[model samples]
Target: MRKHWKSSAVSIAIATSLTLAGCSSGSGTNDKENVSSAAPSSQSSGGVSESGFPIVPEPIKLKMFTRIAPVNGPFKDMPVFQDYEKMTNIHVDFIEAPTDGFAEKKNLLFASNELPDAIYRSGLSPLEATRYGASGQLIPLEDLIEQYAPNLKALMEQYPEIRAGITTPEGHIYAIPGIVTLAAARTDKKWINKAWLDKLNLKVPETTDELYETLVAFRDQDPNDNGQKDELPMTARAGLSVVTMMSGSFGLDQQLGYNINIDNDQVQIWMGDERNKEMLMYLNKLYKEKLLDPELFSHKEADFLAKQGSGKTGFFFDQTNNNFLPIQDQYVGIAPPAGPHGDRLQAQTAPIARDFGAFAITDVNKYPEATMRWIDYFYSDEGSTLLRFGREGEHYVLKDGIPYYTDEYSTAENQPKITPYAGGGAPHIISDQVASYINPPQVQEAQKQLDPYMPKVKYGAPMFDEETAQRVNVLRNDMDKYYEEQSTKFIAGALGFDKWDEFQSTLKKMGLEELQQIYQEAYDKTK
Candidate 1:
């Protein structure tokens, strides 16, 4: 990915050199001050010229740090950045790092006092944002946003809860948030082997009773036709599968902590809830009947994938069929199986519209107006599309005014070769709407398949307060470890229901009450 950005980096460097030479030639005087003076006018709607360019005195350069996926192509010289700089008339000095190295590099940069003018997708936690904002290391964008960011301001007006969610208790927003409109497509869906269903002549299981019967048939009938009795009805990577889609079937929230709604006002821990015990009992019955995978608790993702690829498992939960079946035609996505209690639950983990991964201006920036104006352009439909898809006719083409990715840039065969195009850049630089505008046909089809199922899913709790977040983070970690350990023992028949009280005692001793209290308070604050 770094190789793909070479051209863009070279272009930026050339532009910077030309700007420097022009400055040295005395063609410009007080360039910074002049640019700064043009800032306020740009805040108004009529400040930009008909060409959609801000009426700033001269172009100003700003530094930025960002990360890209390893397969996303090279960063420094990518044509996307070059095109962005050329079009916006704002040179961006970018420090592009690979995704794996992003967190470490960002932390080092902050720790070493070598911060850039702005950070995009820095992956800083909410806690880090609060700490940095409080320390003045990061500037609150509330004033700058009001004065210079009309697009962002309008976005806030449309989603006021989002504004409140990201706003600090002191009434300042420390970071800009990524916007995602649909939340339902974010949950893990129950995928079953359609081939196996056909082999057994079984319709898709909608109820828990039907699912159990189907699993029993798969276990005994050997739907794979392998002749061996080596079939697992369902297999999951233990802790990963213990959440909402599965546990919610028993009328219990799958997620831990303050997000679990006891009533309208109360937040409680799901583990201590009686519904959880019932869920455990049901799971134990599956274990006793040999319907559950024996090695599930010990399996890694790779192990699960191996099982999936081998066609040994009948059903499992995953974010998408793409994770297990590359051939979308082969599998079926069924609604989560209903429990005995008639609860047909779905998991909702949609990306928040204003919860982080947005661009922000820094106090250290010498050209705030130029920077804000250039960034604000990204909010425009045209500008957003350009950032997301690349230059028209180069990365994409228009048909009847609907944008589509060009074959040369969108096909799997051309992906590596198309690195020079701007479509490969970080998503944080653009909006989801823009990306969807130029998405490949296959991607568009997949999204359509997933969209209708989204509304059926439910979201977890709101974000907890700082202190509560820290405590829940700690408690969840411990709780998960305990769950994993105890769950494995119970499923393997090493621990029995006779010792259920003992397990409860152990959880209480591990500070479960303290953890629950912290979450309850945070949940109240959100309300």
Candidate 2:
């Protein structure tokens, strides 16, 4: 049902450019009567309608790829999708990739030109989107958004940064971003086992030393009270995230955070700083003393969550554990403990404009207009509600104008599996209104614990030009690999502290300064 995108050779660029330019640009004078408009035609556009349920007059199937956790079963078996198909008159041939190795598989799909009609839940980096869109592996969507996606159009007008964040150097929009408007949904909170602390007669840690001592107590005191040394004092999931989650105490952030500290509008990369060295030493101390989880670098999310929920995890960090683990009220969110130098920045804060690649169309699609109209639904309030809370009467019930999951889906285990938003792969808006309903009170209170220490000015992702994007990716690819390797060794004590200076020097030699300069230039342009 698809043709090879074969994006090789110089001639392909011209052909692709012509194809992109020739598509309707929403100029009223040149409107195609046969395409997504009144007049009927044989093209897939004939099935598409202007508005309402059954996005198309007739059934049409789109092949797309997205992530799936094992617990969620097959994507097609999802209740929302099962109901949504009847509502939309659209069938999705979902190519499900397991969440763990999905990234490597996604890369292979693009590299091998085994293009799906679209990519949903696509975590496309700005570089990947730009590179592919520029080369025509992915199609430009700005014109399509203008013509077909009223919901998305309204958002771009409402949040102008959405446009700025997703637009490419050549002024093409390759992907639709998932916007997170909820304040509490943004940052990772450092969660401590309040039950453990109370059992050990300990207060929440206030300083680095206090945290160290408390962890030691957790190791020796048998806080779980089973009289067995089975408690894991601290743990992480999906490998090295413990470092990222705890990095704020040392004054850095995680994931898409890129280790930046923008103080007084001066951008700096903290990877090479001596303060980071201190943080590494502290982590090493924890490692040597067995205060940290012995499986910190190797534990999977499933294992970690099971352990956290089992009443023996003294500490962990995540956006919210109330939904993931059964020990909801047992743990309390702690603010970043004061480091030796007293820097206690929260690890991350929600930026209005977060990830840009939520959904994208590849050039092989014959139904770009239909696809745009279908995906745009999630951007609307009604569509977002469906994606988040499912059909209101069935999945949730309204009580005093607030949506609450029914008893059948109320427990942590069932809610995560049954909620329409489970797996979190949809290209939808989770507005503050949605967050108010979905983020349990415990989660809300935990987020409050983090508010005072969060950075005053939370910087969103920087939009780099194509050339700068390429260079930054090149430098970051090498430097990030080296940093993670060396840092892990530093924490595990595989690398001696004497090599610390060598690590810093290696970072500098690997274009660390130039990387900072590029980000600085991008950051400045945002101002």
Candidate 3:
């Protein structure tokens, strides 16, 4: 889900081969020297115990397939892993692939019976995890967690919903989940061009009416000082929907593109909702008045940036810190606009509570216990932080009771920023007992912003059942195609509310009813 985009063919081939070979061989110790030499420590690196004991030894070599690009560059080795090997006596042989090709390469590897000792940052769906685990290609992690992962177990106890989210109905955990603590900051925020607001002498809009009035002023008053009515009141790129932040304002659940929650328990096609009709009607008004970007539906990322950089857009929605902050200096994150129904809701999606990046033991692994123990260390606070942030003093520093990035790691320096410490690369790993290890000030501020609207944060029911998951996946793809086409048509003024009924009928014909039922059944099961 992190938007890392890059690809290369050679890396893909190497990664594919490594994965296939790992899966095909039932013993992990076949390449003992390669695994042992990779470790940082001498303690129990790879071989069996001298006692010839039945119990597996501590510390082992693990082969991992991951999408996390090494900090120095592509194919560069990770120092943190080296340190981990030394400290825990576990060496991990990593098969790194570019994020763009990770999913495809992983799929190929799975099909070829070449699996690594573990997978980190895998793109497996819940259904895939279930299928693989059921077929014994992937081992159940629950017993491992109970026997070896004390740190992870404690965290799960504190937040039990995470267990529910990752657990299969059969009560096995196929993957270790990555936890995201900064829920508030994760919600996309509506951002407005403060420079334009200041020029027009307008305050930040809160309610929909206020927003509309301000946007109108922005359009007519030439806030950009160009002496031309070239301002676009609001806009988003063609594929990215800006309306998700606004939908909650219209008294709809936190639905976007395909997933819609009806009456708090049922999931259905969002575009088929009556409220969607109302939303489309409003969008049509914006289009008719020329307030919306005329090319919004067809605009590429480059085009979107051009519009924003050219000072033509008055408002847009995005992750405030990650997207908007990097570009414009004069912008403020605002609460979702209030709507006619007195709703001012914001959509907050759930973060994977377990390691979204997982480590799976292969049947080929000779020292399974050693591998498990090394991975178990990952669940430990110390190990997690090390993997996520690198050696602390090098990547980050503790200053006056707060953890802050060093000058070398600061974004302001234009230095090669470390990925693990930065958002989207890896979850922050810190000592579980260390209060200072909590999120940074900016993330805390973002969370505070959402506290006022937390009561309105509603979640769609879980859709994890195998059959229901497959149906949902199929419907999701179809709905995405339909929504993209229809939304473009509506935004471009090629479609209108006059065809709204027809749109709903078309959605039903496309299996919306079956999708809804599937979701409903899943929801009931969860309850």
In model 2, where do residues sit more than 4 Å from their true spots?
Answer: 1-51, 111-114, 253-256, 323-325, 411-420, 435-438
| Local distance difference test, candidate 2 | 0.70
| Cα misplacement distance, residue 114 of candidate 2 (Å) | 4.6
TM-score rank, highest first? 2, 3, 1
TM-score, model 3 to reference: 0.79
Estimate candidate 1's RMSD in Å.
10.0
State the lDDT of candidate 2 residue by residue for 1-527, as single tens digits: 00111111000000010001011111001111112121332323445566665566667777887766555656676666777778766688777777777667777777777788788875676777777787788999999888778878887887776776677656788877777767677777788999889988999999889999999999999998888998888877765676767777776653124776665556788898887888889899999899988787887677877876778888887787653455677898887888776777776665555555768888888778878877777776666666666667777887766667777766655654654356664688777656644467777888888887765444555556667777777888798889989988898889999998889989999999998887677666665
Looking at model 2, report the run of 10 residues with the lowest lDDT sum: 9-18
Which one is best on TM-score? 2
lDDT of 1 by residue, 1-527 (tens): 00000000000000000000000000101111112122333323333322244334355566777665544565445555677665545666666666555556666665665667776545455556665677676778777667666665676676565565566667777766655443322445566778888998999887778988888998999887989998779877655365444765665552211225344445566665566667777777776788877776677767876776666778876644434444545566676667777765453344334235355545566655555556555555565556555668887787766556686766533443334222232223234445543333433444454454333222233344455556656766777679768866666678887888888888898888887676556445554
**At residue 458, what lDDT does model 1 achieve?**
29
Better of 2 and 3 by lDDT: 2
**Residue 524 shift from truth in candidate 3, angstroms:** 1.8
Candidate 1 local lDDT, residue 150? 68
lDDT of 2 at 457: 45
- lDDT minimum window of 10 residues, candidate 3: 7-16
lDDT of 3 by residue, 317-389 (tens): 6543434334556666567777877776564444335234344555445655455555545554455545554
